[model samples]
Target chain A: MSAPAQELPRPGGFPEIKYKRNIPKVGPSGLTLLVGITALCTFGLYRTGQGNLERRELEREKVWARIHLVPMLQAEADRDTYRREVADKAREAEIMKDVKGWKVGESVYNSDRYQPKTYAVVP
Target chain B: MSTYREPTLPTGKFVDPTPAPAESAHPEVGATSAPLKSAAYFIGAHCKEYNEDFMLCKNENADPAHCLKEGRKVTRCAMDLITKLRENCEKEWVAHYQCLEKNNQEYYACRKPERTLNECVFSKIKLEKVIPGASGTPIHLRTDSIYS
Candidate 1:
């Protein structure tokens, strides 16, 4: 080998933090804190979890959301059924109008909510 | 029709838990406050009002990161343990109603609450005169609310 290898010099100018090998593995204060934290966490979790075993609904909420979901599904199905029934009746009565009455553009029936509703008396 | 494979959940799978607090913490520094309360602050933040009552005392000069590191480790362990314990009971709850119909479900009454509960009038109904039990002393209540 030609010239000996050289180690890089310390950078431009900040004091470096020194590490002491002989420092106590864990300072006494830190150990004490850790013990205390562990104990508190254990206790709090145990206490909080006690009530979780019950299958109780959050009855006090204002929305009462859980009570509504199933009914909402059924309502959707029922609406489809009503729509089909109305359509069939309209065909039987030989009635037709510009559909999509709910909006400003076309007039499906006399009312927007239900187009050509129940043409029983055939208006 | 496409062959349907159940979609993999976007969320990561629940990992098998380990003895976390002991391993996760910084070995040198430790907690300066209640371990449970601090950890609970992470998920169950609503319980924080009582933190002072449970905080652990520790040296001020200790590396602040050290104590926080320890606290995080313990908190992780605690949360993992708590979730595991509640797994079976954490399923979403369902409610049923009889007086409703399919489309009627969408009716104004279905979406909005049709009923509410007030305090039961019989809340303090006394079955019998209070008597001493192994744990505490006895007390009594009168029968009628209006008088005597």
Candidate 2:
């Protein structure tokens, strides 16, 4: 009756309809991300293994060297001493030859190559 | 406590103008050469036993003349090795031989550039400084002298 009652749209007219489209069903790139992470972990693991192998080889070589060092050093020392003694002997022999006026390699003192000259003692 | 002062008054023929030569000045006493014993020991491959025997003879007061056999044995052994060394190290041998034959000098000249002959001999021979009392020691002496 109030001016044909301007039909005041019912307060909740359109049945409260709301539109939604399955949220586009978005999922992370799970397979690609998983592969990338797995590859990175594997590379890191391989590098660590390689370093360990090299370290072990070096350790083995050092141990072997330590084991044989003493004998090698001793042999070198003996050879050096022998060489020195022989050189000294050669020098002494040369001096003896000079004093006696004997030919080189002559063994007059202990051999029959020559004899010492003797003179009468003066009283 | 007082410094002592000695009296000096005698001045009658204190010094001899013509001093007599000391016996040690004789050439034989002063004769120097590469010691025969060491030469025999080092140059030879296996003459330690012979060297020991020679030393024993000397220690017993045997005349040096009596030791000639052992001495010759040692030299012969060394000479044998030296000959082999010449064959083994021909290059070094030529240099050493030329020095001795032409220059009339010892083989030591070859050692100036490098110890070629020495290196060869040492490789082929065993050098022992002392004769061990223990038996069963190896002896590598050859019987005949190459030079002779």
Candidate 3:
């Protein structure tokens, strides 16, 4: 009882009390990260769209080219056929030269019994 | 050993090839797929009349002998167009076709080089690449295409 015991002040404030404010829940670093992710996703979507458009254009071109190619290809095939026929006629003439009364390209049977058919003779 | 003889071969009937028609004597166009694709539209535009005539001849008769003259004309016209392109737009032509060769001969993938070649051909050769049946503005001329 030495002069009523002096009251000791608490060593610190109540342990449950917080000194700093958490007003803005997200920090500047977190906001930056969110923005970066959004931009990257948008860019990826744009690239995908661009790739699709290019693929469609390629398909269109292929179709157009194929349509236009028919006539040219037909003409090429015709030229080959004409050349082959000419060669065949020449070969037939050479082969039948010595045979008596053998017409190279005429029908072989009397009274149109057998019409002339062009056979694909191998050389 | 069994005497399994192959049939006796026929003799004295050799294939004596004759010259092709004079009109069809020109050498074939030597360009392969990529280069030909690069110049396809231009060739179409340039050879329209000859191509149409050849087709008409083919329609008249299925016999190829009937269309030999028209076919030769078509071949000549295509060769002429290729020659003109080579003479006038060599650099641009090479660049565009090389791009096409790299990108599977797809026209859309080589628009930049194609544009250069188109401009050159139009200026020097006075020939334009016209798609035959495109309804509206051709896709090639569109500047705002996202893929381009």
How many clashes does each candidate structure show, in the order listed?
A: 6, 13, 0
The docking category that best describes candidate 2 is incorrect
Model 2 agreement with the true structure over B1-148: per-residue lDDT tens digits: 1134465555653332232223111111111122221122244235445545655654554333344445445444545544554466556545544544443333222233124544654665543322223223211221221211
List candidate 3 stretches off by more than 4 Å: A1-57, A66-73, A96-120, B1-23, B135-137, B143-148
Write model 1 residue lDDT over A8-74, tens digit each, in one string.
6667855776775666665568878899999999988866564232112111111222221212222
Give candidate 2 misplaced runs (Cα > 4 Å).
A1-123, B1-41, B44-46, B96-112, B124-148
Candidate with more favorable, higher TM-score: 1 or 3: 3
**Local accuracy of candidate 3 as per-residue lDDT tens digits, A47-121:** 888767655665676676665454566677676666766677677788777778866656455653423245656
Best candidate (score: lDDT) = 3
Displacement of residue A84 (Cα, Å) in model 2 is 37
Pairs that collide, model 3: none
- Candidate 3, residues B108-130, lDDT tens digits: the string is 77989999999999999888876
lDDT of 1 by residue, B1-148 (tens): 1235566653754432322233232221122222221112122222122221122311322222223433443344434533432342122101112212332332122222121100110122111211122122211121211110
Off by over 4 Å in 1: A1-31, A47-56, A59-80, A92-123, B1-117, B120-148
Candidate 2 per-residue lDDT, tens place, A1-123, comes to 466656667776757556755566466688988999999999989877855654454344333323222222222333333333334446456556546554543443776543322421111
